[model samples]
Target chain A: MVAISDLKKISEYEWEIPQSFRADMRVPVRFFVTRDLLEQALRDASLEQAVNAATLPGLVGHVTVMPDMHQGYGFPIGGVAATRYPQGVISPGAIGYDINCGVRLLGSQIEAEAAKPRLDVLATALNKYCPSGVGQGGALKLTERELDAICVEGAEWAKKRGYASDADLRRTEEGGRLEGADPAKVSPRAKQRGRPQIGTLGAGNHFIEVDVVEEIFDEEAAQVMGLHAGHLALQIHCGSRGFGHQICSDYVRAFQGAVKRYGIQLPDRELVCAPLDSPEGQDYLAAMRCAANYAFANRQLLAHWARQAFEETLAGGVKNWHLHQIYDIAHNMGKVEEHVVDGKKLKVCVHRKGATRAFGPGFPGLPAEYQKIGQPVLVPGSMGTASWVLVGTEGSMQRSFGSTCHGAGRTMSRSQAKKQIWGEDLRKELEGEGIHIRTGSLAGLAEEAPAAYKDVDAVVETVTGAGIARKVARLVPLVVVKG
Target chain B: MFTLTTTYQRNYKGSVTWGVGCDFQLEVLPFFVGIGKIRYTGKTMVTETGYREIEHTADWELEVWAPNLSSLLETAARGMYALAQMQLVDGERESREFEIPFGDRESLLVDFLAELLYLGEGEGLVMDEFSFTFDGNTLKVRAWGAPIKNQSKEIKAVTYHRLQIRETEFGLVVNLVFDV
Candidate 1:
């Protein structure tokens, strides 16, 4: 176990564990966290896992962990690592099982005061339109050929089918489609799983939330993002479902042998990896991209259904019920990009497991209107807590690998939460607070209790204080649909 | 009913004995470790295999133990089903038979569970009766169950994090972490 004495304090919001802490580590581990959050992280194995991640071969700079860090399977949640391109390795476990699991925010002009009366109807419509729960398939059953198309085309495929608009594509990360997605690389079993699960909000921490913009910190940035205080906004959180899970499982299993063949030694088997130049590495990357694209299309389809739900509930009753896309950002992904490392521009693969890419202002990838500002960073809180909207900063590019915290990380185990909190009681409490709740399983609700996670506001304060991200707006949930 | 007939007997403490006949086996050992501990009652009529949940902040961890690899696999499957709150409806029994090319013990364990997860999610099947035959470099499994009636949560994948099948004094013990 790592203690606070092992760390070198850099600032109030920053700390470092030097490479000397472990002989096997190739690089140091940098932490963007408040002292309180760091103490919370020490209570778990997250810091130790981050230390293990630092042992990956060909790692550049340092392994960066966000303030909302928690213990994940192999890699710590809220971890970011950049490896030298072409020769460096990519670990499937580092990118996570839910490939491209992300958040999409949609802003609308519908005022919360005017829509209060029909909030329940809107919640019901959202639940009815969006298929959720364990093993729930979406409305569309695509053929193998169409599934292949979705693999390559991503949200563009949805746009062609009238599920997305042009602006929706532009505002999404990587335009909601990752290039070089090869369906041939994905396993047949993965394709079979992907066929029916597209456009679904599968269970376990995935939710579609209706929120009212509670406060605006950056007025200009909020206006550019079409976010208005006291207005309604929707947040969709999900991923590629079983398709991605199977793909990740297939590769993780395959890489267990790859690590042996390449003679790469690691402390943890789950941190298995292959050199980017290897055939195994290339195939996994291709398959992973397919899953990422599938997720983009999945969220796009959900957004379309959410729009219909809004229209159905408030079409004639409200004047402007349209929900425009704010931004869709993926927290779990591996991308090949150029970044300044050691004052030199180097191409690297940034593996962000539970961290969002927070590219600073003037990055070429941002949409035209967001070029002056930065890419939007969506940090969802636990259910019934305040979610935040932040933007990238230049400090993020210099210190970290252009990444920020993903959400309010879990502090309590599911079993513990379930034991301590009752789902019925939580539901009644939230409903009493005027938050509409729709869910399939109350047990799942108990597992996701707000007490299970850290405070989101404190997490945001740490990041903004560290100058890695700037807060734009705060959102309070009014309706939450969980699977 | 899956008939279980006694095949072996043991009198030593901490020794594992098995009653095997039909699709399932009744494993008896002196003592069980981890979650639900089963004590030696001297009569050898109760199950010794068991699993229990461990505290993990972001995912599920299960500590499972049994007399052998086959019993360990079955117990782990039961633990996973319990974690997901999966229930099967009363109906005609369905069975699935398949072979997994064995690499290592850990890989085989993961592959076996992954296969079960696929079946549960894709085919809506949950197996309670399991028979395993280990040949040269291969594992043949026959599982019997009914269609799933309800499942509260979904486990995204079974992870290889710190997965090691250890030989204990009593039996085999392993810790499995699941991505939920």
Candidate 2:
């Protein structure tokens, strides 16, 4: 177990566990969390997992963990680790099973007061249009050839099918399509799973939430993103579904031997990895890109359907019901990029499991309008809580490798949450608070109760306090659809 | 030839019997059961194999114990089904058979459960009766079950996180984590 005494406090919201803490660790571990959050994190194995992640070969700088960190399977959920490109190792487990699991925020001009009456109808329409729940297939069933095309093209494939607009692609990370996706590297079983799940919002912490922008901290930044206080916005959170899961599983299993063949030793088997330049690593990277593209396209299709739902519910009843893309950012991914490390520029693969890429202003990737305002970072709170919209800072680029917290990380186990909270009663309580709820299973809702997660406001405060991210707006959920 | 009389109940602490080779009685208790201990009474005996859930913040972890690898896999499968709250409707029954190449004990366990997850999600099927045959380097399995009537939760994939099959004083013990 990792203790607070093992850490050297850098600031009020930052701490470091030096490499000397463990002989096997190649680099140190840096944490961006408040004292309270850090104390809470000590009760779990998240910090230990972060320390374990520091042992990956060719790790540069340090392993960075966000304030909303929680214990995940192999890697801590809010972890970000960057390794030297070409020779450094990349673990499939570090990127997570849900490749490119991300959040997409859509802003609209529809005022909360005007949309209040139709909120229930809008929620129902969103649920009806978006295919969700366990083992739920989407409307479109693609052929093998079509699936391959999607693997390579990503959200562009959706755009060709009239599911996305130009601005939507521009505002999305990597233009909604990651480069270097090779379908041939992906397994047939993965393709089979991907065929019918292209546009699905899979169960387990994935949701489509409608929120009202209650407060704006950065007025100019909010305006540039088309976010208006008291206006309606929608958030879609999901990932590559079974396709990514199979790809990750296949590689994690295959890498069990890869580690042996490469003669790399690690404390945990789940941290199995290979050199970034090795054939095995390249193959996994190629397959992982396919899943990432699939997820981008997945969110795009859902956004299209969400737009249709909005049109259906508020077409004639309200004026300006259009929902424009604010920003779409992936929280789980491995991206190859150039960053300054040890006073030198180096290309590295940044593996962010449950952390978002928060590129500061002046990066060329941002849309022209957002060049002065930095990349948008979406931090969704637990159900019936306040979600946040933030932007990257130079501090993030220098210290945390351009990453921030993903969401309000879970503090309680699912079983404990289920044992403590009744889903039906929680639903009644949320409805009483005027939040419309649509779900396939009440048990799932119970597991995701607000009490199960840390406070989102506090998580955001830590990041902003640490100067890694800047708050732009705060959103309060009005309707939540979970699967 | 063994006559397997299997009965599946959906009630809390549902019990099922897997009569394999001998007149064996099986029960699914709400909590973890001990390793197999043979107690003969005339011509009938009881076999114990069980799994229990472990606390994990973001995912599901299960600890299973059995007398052998095959029984451990079966108990883990049943435990996974129970975790998902899967229920099968009464109607026509279906049997499916498949083979998995034996690599290591942990890989085999993950592959077996992943195959079951694929079947449950892709074909809407769940297996109750399982027969295992271990060859030189492969595991052949024949399973019987029906379409799923309802499932309350979804498990995304079986993870290899801290997965190790151990030989204990009582039997073979293993811990599995599922990304839900």
Candidate 3:
């Protein structure tokens, strides 16, 4: 645990744990948090995890944790680390168990008021049309060969199948496919876990919510994202599901000895890693990409289901009920890219766990349509809370390695939340707030009560104030489905 | 009645465990670890009884059982080592044992395994097995793992949040989520 007084304040919103704090640490640990939130964060093991991450081999740039950060297995949920690409190491633990668990948002022409009565119907239709809530399978059950195609093709595969549009591919990070995804690198067991889950919304913290575009911060950017005040939009929060989870689990175990083989020393076993250019590192990277692609394909399929639900519910009332894919971005992943560190443009693999990619405008990877607006960064709040859509900024490049907070980080444990709140009562509370929810269990609902998380507004404010991302729109949830 | 469906795609074949807790076995790792679904029958709800033990496979023996998915998952955590006959000595037994209460079944599965790994790794306590009872949102779990002479795998931390645990007449089912 870090003593609050030991922190060296960088500003009102940032604090630093310098290298001198520990002998094994290769770099200092930086945290972006408000004064109050920082105090709350100190009560958990997340700070220790961040400090431990600083000790991993090949780590470049200071280790950083976002305000929404919370305790995770090896690294803090909102942790970020960059290692030299070829010589540095890749640790599955840094990426997390649910690999490529990300967020995707779609914009529609329909208005919230116009779709009010249909909200419930659409929710039910979506629940039926799109398999959700624990162990649900997708509409398309891929053969081994087809699953391989998905691992390699990603959202492009969806595009070919008419599930995704060209524009949709254009807006996704890495165009919905991370390069170097070798199907051979992914274990057969991991593949098996992903095979049936494609296009399915696997449970836990994964949700598809209906939102009303309540406010727009940047008019031009909002226009590019197809967001309009009072318009209805759909946000899907899920990822590679069992496929990604299995990949991470498989690799973390595989890398257990790699850390020692590479002569790397880590504070936590969960932080095990291997050099990027090494055989083990390459294998993990390839598998990571496979999981990432699987996630893109998974979200694309869910988008299809959402479209079908809207069409079935609206039934000729709204034409072109297709939910236009605004953008899909990954928060938990490792990407090999070139970034200027200490004035040298070195290729490094950036590991973002529970943090979103906020690439500024003019990056080569973006679609032609969004070149001027920057990458869309989606930050979801907990159940019955406000979610925001933001865009990357130039300041991010200079500081956070083009990263921002992912969501309202956890403020309490599930047990803590459950002990304090009743699932039925919480449901009533959210309903009173006009947010409709469909869940597998009432007890589960109470654990996700909005109070269990930090104020997303404060977390978003820190990043926006830090210039890592500029808020574009705030989405108020109308309906939520949980697993 | 919780219904479970398994789909095999490409090289990937997985199952979704949902519905009452009948799919609890799916929540247990090295047993049925994957995706699957369960739907409540809205019919007869009976008294749920369960049992857990480590089963020996051809190569590796693992803790196995059904305890309404959540408890089964929690037991699986201890089962992983108890199958190896590890015991959590009285001296090493945790005074304040870690419990990861999941909101739903999915997160509960993951959280249960994660807790096992966490206890084994963070505290260096080798647990054998655990029993559980659910009270609304709270999952009361008592886990046991014997101390190992030499440890091979170190379990890390456990998470709840999206963690899942469920109950059904098919014999209590749960998913064990590990951060291994």
Candidate 4:
């Protein structure tokens, strides 16, 4: 176990565990955390896992961990490791099981005061229109070939099918579609699993929440994103479903032998990896992008369903129930991005497990509207807490590889949360607080109790204080749909 | 788990009795009542097949042991279902047979459990009786189960994070990580 005192404090909100902490570690681990959050991380293996991640071959810069970091399977949840492209290794376990699991924010002009009377109806409509819970299927069905197209084209497929608009694609990361997605590299079993789950909001911590923008920190940025105080915003959080899981599983298993062939050694077997140039690595990347694209399409379809829900519930009730696209971003992914390392610009595969890409303004990928404001970084809090809307800063590009924290990271395990809180009671408490709750399983809801997570405000504060991200707006939940 | 085999004998006779010529790793935890038997620590003994819960902040991890590869797979599956809080209906029983290609014990274990998870997540199926016969890189599984009437949690998928089937003094011990 790593003690808090063992770290070399870089700043009040930053700490370092040098490579000397473990001999095998190729680079030091840099933490974006405050003292309190640092202590919260020490209680779990998040830091230790970060140290284990530091051992990945050919790691560049420090292995950066966000303030909301928590221990996951092999890598810490909020970790970012960039390796030299075509030379360094890519570990699927580090990218996580939920490939491209992400958050999508949609801004609306519907005022909370006007929608308050029908919030219950809107929540019910969302639950009814948008599928949730275990084994839930989407409204749309597709052939294996269509699913393959979605695997390669992502949200662009949705646009072609009229599920998405031009503006929606414009605001999404990588234009809601990643290039180099080769469905041939993906398995048939993975395709079969994905065929019927195109737009589902599958169970376990996944959700569609309706929130009212509670506050605005940066007026210009908030206006650019269409976030106004007292207005509603919708958040969709999920991933590639079973398709990504199987793809990741298939590769993680195949890479076990790859590590031996590549002569790479690691401390954790869960951290199994392949050389970036190897066939195993190239195949996994190609397949991972398929899952990534699939996820993008899934969220796009869910957002379309959400718009339908809004129209069905509030079309006649309000003048504008229309939800406009703010931005969509993936929290779990491995992208080949250019960053200056040791004053040398290099294309490195940035593996962000539970972190957000927070590119500063002036990046070429940004839409024309957001070129001056930087990329939007959505950091959702736990149920009943405040979610945040931030933008990347130049400092993030310089230090953290253009990434920020993902959410109010879990402070307790699911078992611990279940043991400590009752789902029914938590639901009641949240209901009492004016947050409508719709969940598939009461036990599942109990496991996601707000008390189980760290303070999102403090987490946001740390990153903003570290100058990696800048705050734009804050949101408070009005209705939450969980599975 | 000793009780696991005993339960298999009581609940699924055909499966526990199939494949007679295989060594059984017989050690059971203290009344292994689902995931409740686990300690809230990272290193708590499940006490069945030397399987124990390893503390993970987000996902679930179990360290399982057996005398050989086959027993190790069984113990790990038992541990996994326990964590998911899987249960079956009493009157409506069902069974399914599966033929899955395997490369090694690690991949075989992942693919096998992934199949079970798919059944549960897709069709609400749960099984008590299971028979696995491995011929080279193939595993033929004959399983008896019922629709999952009660499941407290749902695991997203099984992962290969440091998954290894090792030969130890007592048996083959390995740690499995499940993405929840």
Candidate 5:
């Protein structure tokens, strides 16, 4: 474990672990958190993990971890690193197992008051229309040919099928499709696992929430996102499903040797990497993009299903259900982006594992509609807690390469949470808080109890405090559907 | 045929059972270190739906049995390198020490193995053999190997999801489910 004393206080919200601490480190390690939260984060080896990530080959700037950072497989969740493009190494572990495991938010026309009475009906419709749960399969089953298309085109595939709108595709990161997705690079087993799971929410912390926009902090930004105070909204949190998981697993195992071939010495095995220009690195990146596209399509289809469920359950053909895609962003992904580093316009592979891309205004990626307001950052809170909507700031690009916190990070482990809370009782407690939940298993529910996480409000406070992302609105959940 | 029942239960989550058919009752863990017993049977392997099916690996492959999922996974991990005739060294040599941390249990196991590989390659420690103790979620293990000799398989970092280690009445069953 890295001693807390080794952490140099950079600011009230920033702490740094200098590269001098480790000889192999290419960059320093920086963490964003409040003093109290910093203490909690240190309870586990997440800081150590962050420090270890700093030692990867070709890393640039400091290995920056967001406030939501937690111990993850190879890299800590909410971790960010920008490695020199082409020559910099890419670690499958750094990208994570659930590749493109991200959150997408949709805003509807219905107001909170009007939607409250019919919450149960909406929840039931969503649960039925959107398949969720462990080992659950979706209604749409794709053949190998179609699956390959889905992997390649991502949201574009959904748009072609009329499941997505042009506007929806425009607002998504990378226009909802990343470049260089080579399906052939994805193994058959990974394809097999993904073939049946599209449009389904797999188990473990993945959820679909029906929330009411409680408050709008930035009116101009809210208007651009079609979000208003009291507007009913839907937030879908999932990934490329078994497909992404398998792809990452397959590559992480494959790259174990690439580290040696490249003569790279990492502080942790989880940071195993291959040079971006190398054949192995190129193949893994391609495969990772396939998973990213799959996740985009997966969420797009879920949105379609959600709209259908609303139309079926409510009157007026659910015309009141104006579910506009606010924005979809990839949190766990590595993208080759051009950024200014040390007064040089250098291309780098920015890996945002369990972190969100917070591109500010004037970036070319956003649709014309959102170009003025900047990227819509979705920060989903813990179950039964308040989530937030933030917009990227110019300060973000200058500082953390246009990246920000992903969600309310965890404060406790699953076991620790389970030992302290009961599944049945926790259900009752959430319901008492006026949040309705339907879960596949009670134990899973207990493991995800709100107390198991840090306060979303506080985490958001740190980001806004640091000026990386500015608050736009706050969302309070009315009903939740968990897988 | 022998009937193998693998059960997984979370104190808070649901439990699942997977059945495999083999012809043997393996000696459970704590019974022996390297070898275990298997009673051969003639019955067929059954699926969750109760339909019998044919399997090749279970029918003829050699499996090292343990009592729990951790040991099962450990030995399975060991089995991968053991096949290479990797030699074990005494833990007496005081070498570089580092901490391996993971997000979850399965990733923890992967990190454990990766640590051994790193020692073998990075620090010049030839890791041919190792043993581990699971204290809750943390693992502390002793590994043996000569100084870094040459490259073996490039073992990357471990993952956390879809990891399975099951205990059965017959013996321990571990699934080497890798993301890669």
Candidate 6:
């Protein structure tokens, strides 16, 4: 176990574990956490896993962990590591099983005060329109050919099909489509799985929630993102479903042999990886992008259905009831990009697992309106709490590869949470607080009880204090749909 | 369940035993080492085939011990269904079979469970009876079930995260971690 005494403190919000602490580590491990949260992380394997991640080959800079870090299987949940491109290594486990599992925020002009009376109706409509729960299919059924197109076209496929608008595509990350996605690289079993789950919200912590913008910290940034105080916004949190799962599983299993072929050694078998320039790595990257694009289209379609739900519930009740896309960003992904480290511009593959990309101002990827500001970083809190909206800063680019925390990370195990919290009682409590709750399973609900996670406000404070991200707005949930 | 003598067995304190009693198996390496042949129970080794839920921090983990590989696979399937809270329908039984080319043992394990998940989600079908046969690296699975009448959870994927299939002193032991 790693003791706190071994850590080299950099600042109140930053700390480091030097590479010399572990003989195999290629780079040091950096911690973006408060002292309190660091204590919590010490109780679990999050920090140790972050240290393990530092051992990956060709790692550049530090293995940066966000404040909302938690213990996961191969990699810590809120981890970001960049590897030099071409020859650098990419670990499928580092990217995660749910490829492109992301959050999409849609801002609306509908006033929360005016829509209060119909909150339950809106929740029901959203649940009815968005097919959620275990084994549930989505609103649209696609053929193999169409699924192939989505692998390449992403949200643009949705746009052409009238499920998305030009403005919606503009605000999305990479215009909601990744380049060089090859459907041929994705396996047939993945295609079979992807065919049926286009807009569905699969089970386990994935959710669709309606919130009211509680407050705005950056007025100009909020206005540019269309976030208004006391107005309604919707957040859809899901991923590539089984398609990405199979792809990752396939590549990870295949890479077991690849690691042997490449003559690379790791502490954990789950951290199996290959050089980016290798044939195996190229194939996995291509397949991964297919899953990534598929996820973009999945969220885009979900956004369309969400819009439909809003219109059905609030049409004629309010002057306008449309949900415009704020931005869609992947928390789990591997992106190839150029970044400056020590005044050297190098291309690298940034693997962010349960961490959001927070590109600072003037990157040229942002929509014109957001160029002055930075990329929107959506940090969802636990259910029935305040979710934060933040943007990247220059410090993020310099120190952490432009990535930040993902959510109020889990502090308790699911078993512990379920044992301590009753699902029925949790539902009643949230309902009493005027938060409309729709869930598929009570047991799952108990597992995700708000008490199971860390303090979201404190996590945001750490990131903003560290100068990695800037807070823009805070949101309070009115309705939550979970599967 | 029939006990196969082909697998290894250990006698401890003159009792039969099988199960992964940990709430969550520690990291991957120590899990197998920590519990191998060093039976904590003063009484041990019942020689029956069964499975148990081990504690996992984020996802569901299961440990299955049997007298052989086929029975271990069966027990692992049952454990997975139990983890997902799968329930079957009355009145009708549905059957599906999988005959596929095999790779490694771990890959075979993941593919088997993934097939079951695919059936459960895509067609609402599940398994009831089990027959796993291997012939020249070809796996044949024959099973029966009906459309899922009720289910509480969904497993996103069967992962290779610290997956280990062991031929231990207590027959064949396999630990599986699932992504939910």
Chain B superposition TM-score per model: 0.74, 0.75, 0.43, 0.73, 0.46, 0.73
In candidate 2, position A308 carries an lDDT of 94
Write the number of the candidate with greater lDDT, choosing between 1 and 6.
1
| lDDT of each residue in A307-346, candidate 3, tens digit only | 8888889868765566787899999999987787888888
| lDDT tens readout by residue for model 6, A241-265 | 9889889988988898899999998
Question: What ranges in model 1 sit over 4 Å off?
Answer: B1-47
Please give the RMSD to the true structure for each candidate, in Å. 6.0, 5.7, 13.7, 4.7, 13.9, 6.0
- Predicted model 3 interface RMSD: 14.7
True contacts kept of each: 0.88, 0.81, 0.04, 0.69, 0.06, 0.57
* Candidate 5 lDDT tens digits, A313-415: 6656334866888999889999999888888889999999989999899887878888898999999999999999999988788778889999988777553
lDDT of every model, 2 decimals: 0.91, 0.90, 0.73, 0.86, 0.74, 0.86
Worst 10 residues of 6 chain A by lDDT: A413-422
Candidate 4 lDDT over residue span B23-56, tens digit each: 3344433321223223232212323254555556
Candidate scoring better on lDDT of 1 and 3: 1
The window of 10 residues in a row where model 2 chain B has the poorest summed lDDT is B33-42
Across A287-378, the per-residue lDDT of candidate 4 in tens digits comes to 99999999999999999999999999999899999999999999999999999998999999999999999999998799999999999999
Steric clash pairs (candidate 4): A269-B162, A270-B161, A270-B162, B42-B55, B46-B52
Top-down lDDT ranking: 1, 2, 4, 6, 5, 3
lDDT digits (tens) for residues B38-115 of candidate 3 = 221121112233222212100122323454465466445544553222334445444334555545565455545645
Model 2 residue-pair collision total: 0
Clashes of each: 0, 0, 61, 5, 27, 10
What are the runs in model 6 whose C-alpha is more than 4 Å off?
Answer: B1-47, B99-104
User: Which candidate model has the greater lDDT, 2 or 4?
Assistant: 2
Q: State the RMSD for candidate 3.
A: 13.7
